[model samples]
Structure formats: structure tokens, C-alpha cells
Target: MLLFDLDNTLFPFRQYWEEANRTTFTSSPLTNGLSYDAFLPLLKMFDEELWPLHVKEAITLNELRVERFIRTMHALGRSVNKEQSQHYFEAFMENLLSSITMDEELRDFLDKLQQSYTLAILTNGKEKEQWRKIIQLNLTSVIPFEHIFISEDIGYDKPDPRAFQHVLKTLNVEARSATYIGDSWTHDIQGSIGVGMNAIWITPRQASSINENLHLSRTIYDIEPCLFHLNRTTTIT
Candidate 1:
């Protein structure tokens, strides 16, 4: 069986993120002559810092989603009204949430894999947001929604052993018989490995110092060799 992460693993997430942000932030009261150049730095800070805070419960996900706009506006010496903030937030999320495009080649690769093994998506994120991307990417066309597991719906996030265990139990597969693939280091690599499952990192990002010893693949289309090794190794064991 193969389990996967949603963002950055299945599609070109950075391109979509840039597209969504540019579209949503360039209009209305949100930008008071705020150059995209100025906006870029704020965007990076908010995502890198706030996300970890959201994960740690320092703030709710909803707060994490919208507060960055408020902070950015404030930093730019502009006072944003609630209505304006709300509009910007809604537009940004709509774009971000709906931005994932299904990779036809990935679907083809998965089609071949499904013929031999069970494939499931075990991603960490809010339920609606995750499901939206799943549908947006047309993932259900190949894998059933029933096989896709989201962290919020499961009441646990990855890197938590229980999260991985739940998916394995639901799939009726032993941990060693399954492999987890994702971009996040803690959540996908160490998390799955910590639970007794091998992991294939959708890389070139070395998530940890130990990454040198871990299985790695550059792009979604570049996973054939990894999949082959995984299959052969499992068969041997």
C-alpha cells in the first residue's frame, strides 16, 4: 500500500501559491500601493512562522489563515477594516484551496500502481480545505475518497504515531507492508519511519540530517525507481 501527502508532493504547490496570492492581494483595500515586492517578504514570514504556531496550538488555523493579512497591512502603516480583511481572506483562501491542478502524468503513474497495490492519500490539514484540494485535483477519479484520510477528520496529525496507525488499521495493512510518501520531513519521513513503516520522500529537500540515508525522489514523475525498490524489498521481506 502507498500513502501520500497532498501539497508539494502531488503538484507544483509553489506555483499555485504564487498565482493565488498575486491574484487575491493585488486588488481592493488590501493593497495600499503595496508593491508585490514588499508583499513577498511578509508572505514568507507569516507562512514560515505562523504555520508552526498553528500546529502547536498557539493560534487556531483560521486565525493563522487571516491574521497574516492583518499583520501585513499593519506593517504597511494601513488600517484594515474587518469587512476588507474578510473579503481578502475569503478571496485568498478560495484561490489557494482551489488551486491544485491534477497532474495527468501522476494520475497515469498511479493508475499503473493501483493495478498492483492499494494507494491512499493520508494528508494532514483541515478537512474541508483538504477535501477541496482532493476534488480540485480530481484525485477521486483514481482513488476513492474513502481511501483518502485527512488529519482534521481523523482528529490527529502526522508525526503522531496514532495517525499513521489509524490509516494502517483502516487499510488492514501491516506497517511494514506500507510506505508513506510526502514532502514534510517530520510528518512524512520520520513520522512514518517512527511507526515502523518505510518512507519515500518527495524531494530534493533534505528534511533532516539523516535524509542522506532515506529514500528520495525529485519529482512525482521520478518515483518509478523508488516504487520498484519498495516493491522488490517488500517482496523479499
Candidate 2:
């Protein structure tokens, strides 16, 4: 069985996320409540200072989305009322979904892998937005819909044992028989390993530092090469 992370694992999430954020700030009503000129600077502050704090505690992606908007508005001297915050958060998320782009090779690889294994997506994002991305990318055409698990739906994010356990239980697979592939060392690799599943670290960025714990599993820059090796080795086994 194969479990995959959605964002940076299958697509260049950071690149597309930055573009989406910019588009939201420019076009969405989320920025209308604040001083438009100061929104970008506030976003920078939220991304650099506030986000890192949340990430360390293994916050759910939905909470992060809401918190980022609330904090950004507060930093910009705007109101942070819960109702208004929710509105902007929804708008911001909708904008982000419209900006997703999948890696071209990912589709082909997933199609092949699906024929031999029970494939699933274990992603940490809002249910609506994550589903939107999956549909937009046509991932459902290859991957089963029931196998998609989003943090918002499960109320648990990666790096948390509960999330990995949920997937194992649902798939009826022992941890040893399942393999997790994701980009983040903290969330994807460390989290999956903690639950006793094999892990593959997809290091898209060249300058990323290796996590000492992931030294035994496969690491690759591209999905095609990793899939090729998995096919060959699993066949041999």
C-alpha cells in the first residue's frame, strides 16, 4: 500500500502557494477590510514569525489557514473578529484552490502504481480545498476517492501518530505493509516512521538537509525515478 502527501510531495506547493497568496491579496475581499497597501508586509510577518510557531506544535492545516488570516489582519491594524476572520479565511482558501498545479510525471506514475497497490492520499489541509485540488488535478481518475484523507476531515494532522493510525486502520493494512511518501521531514517522514510505516522522503529542493532518522529509506528528487525503483524492487521481492 502507498500513501502520499498532497502539497509539496506531488506538486511544487511552495511555489504555487506563494502565487496563490499574492493573487488572493490582490483580488479577494479579504484584503478589502484591511489597508491593501500594508497587507503584503503583514503577510510576510505572519509567514515568518507566526507560522513557524504553529508548525512546531503540529497544527492542522485548517487552523493554520484561519490563524494566518486572523494574525495577518491583526498585524495590519485590522479587526480580528472571528466572524470576519472566517469570511476572509474562506475567501483566501478558495483563491488558493484555484491556483494548484500538479507535477506532470506524478499522474503517469500514480496511474501505474494504482494497478498494483492500494494507493491513498494523506494530506494536511482543509477538506474542501484539498478535495478541490484532487479533483482539479484529476487525481481521482487514478486514485480511489475513498482513499483520500484530509486533516480537516480527520481532525488530525501528519507527524501525529493518530493520523497515521487512522489511515492504517481504514486501509486494513499493517504499518509494515504501508509506505508513506511526503516532502516534509518533520511532518511526513518523521510522523510516518513514528507509526512504524516505511517512508520515502521526496526532497524536491536541492538544499534540504537530511533527517538522520530517514537515512534508511529511499530519497529522491523526482517522483518518476522513485516509482521506477519501487516497482523494480517490489517486483523482485
Candidate 3:
């Protein structure tokens, strides 16, 4: 079984995020007089700062979504009411979701992988938005609906051993029989490793130390070599 992360692993999430922000902010009157460049950093900073709190259930998803934009506008010397903040957020999300489309190369790669493995998605996000992204990416054509697991639905987020263990139990697979591929080292890699599953780290960041399972992929398209490495390791073991 092959478990995958939705955002950065399945698609270029950071690229999509930047493009979406640029498109939305540049076109929207809501951002008038605010430099998109300046607003973007503040938006990202607050998101990074507040995301852990969201994951820990310290705040509601709606609060996290609206607060980031509110803080960004405040930093830019603008005030926004809740309605305005929500309007801006919805606009940005629509732009972001609309920008997702599966290219032929990715579709083809997933098609081939589906032939040999039971592919599934394990992601951390609100259920509705995540489903919207899945539909936008056209992932249902390749990955089955039931195989997709959201942390919101599971009640346990990534980096938690229980989440991985739940997937393994539900799938009736031993930990050793599963392999997880994702970009986040703390969440995806460590979570799967904690539960004794094999992991492929899909990252561009330089590793502080080298190890057999730590494969730095430039893109998800580069995953073939990492899978090959895993196969070799399995055979040798």
C-alpha cells in the first residue's frame, strides 16, 4: 500500500499558493493600495505562526482562515471587519482551487502507480476544503473516494502515531507493508516511521544527515528513483 500526502507531495502546493495569491491580490479591489509582495509575507508569516495552533485544536479552522488575512491587513495599516476578511479569504481560496489541474505527466504517472499499488491519500486539513482540492485536482479519477483520509475526519493529525496506525488497521495492512510519501518531515515522515512504516521524504530541503530512506525529490515526478531505492532496500532486507 502506498499512502500519499495531498498538498506538496501530490502537487506543487507552494507554487500554486504563490500563484493564487498573486492572481487574487493583483486583481481584487479588496487589496487596493497594498503591495501584494508586502501582504504576502505577512500573510505567510501569520499562517506559519498560527497553523500549529490550528492543528492542536487551539482555534477553529474558520478562525485560522480569517485571522491570517486580518493580521495581514492590520500589518499593512488597514482594518477589515470579519465579513471583509471572509470575503478576501473566499476569493483567494477560489482562485487557488481553480488553479489546480492535473497535467498529463502527473496523470500518467499516477495511472501507472495505481496499477501496482493501492494508492491512498492521508492529509491534514478541514474536510470540505480538502475535498474541494481533491476534486479540483481530479484525483478521484485515479484514487478512490474511500481511500482518502482527512485528519479532520480521523480526529488525529499527522506526526501522531495513532493516525498512521488507524490507516494501517483500517486497510488491514501491517506497518511494514505500507509506504508513506510526503513532504513534511515532522508530520509525514516521522509519523509513518513512528508506526514502523517505510517512508519516502519528498523534499527539496537539504538533509542535515544522509540515510537510506531520506530521498530528496525535486518534484513528485522525481519519485521513481526513490521508489526504486525502496524496492532495492526491501529486496536486500
- lDDT by candidate, in order shown: 0.79, 0.72, 0.83
After superposition, candidate 1 runs with Cα above 4 Å error: 81-83, 205-213
The best candidate by lDDT is 3
Q: What is the C-alpha RMSD of each candidate to the true structure, in Å?
A: 2.8, 4.5, 2.5
- TM-score of candidate 3 against the unseen true structure: 0.90
What is candidate 3's lDDT per residue for 1-237, written digit by digit as tens? 889999989888889889988988998887887787798889989999998898788998899989999888899998898898898878888898888886667778889999878888899988988998898788888989988999999999898999998888887888776788899989999899889888878877652224565556666777777677777765211
- Model 2 ranges with Cα > 4 A deviation: 28-41, 51-67, 70-85, 101-104, 205-237
Instruction: Give the per-residue lDDT of model 1 (tens digit) for 113-225.
Output: 78877889998888988888888788888888789999999988888999999999988889888888888878898999998887888878632323422578777667667
What C-alpha lDDT, on a 0 to 100 scale, does residue 160 get in candidate 2? 89
* Model 1 CA lDDT for position 92: 81
- Candidate 3: where are CA atoms >4 Å away? 205-209, 212-214, 235-237
Model 3, residue 98: displacement in angstroms?
1.5
lDDT, candidate 3, equals 0.83
lDDT of 1 at 195: 87
Better of 1 and 3 by lDDT: 3
lDDT digits (tens) for residues 77-176 of candidate 2: 6657667767766666677777665556768877877777788999997688788889888898788888999998998978889999999898788886
Model 3: how far residue 35 lies from native, Å: 1.3
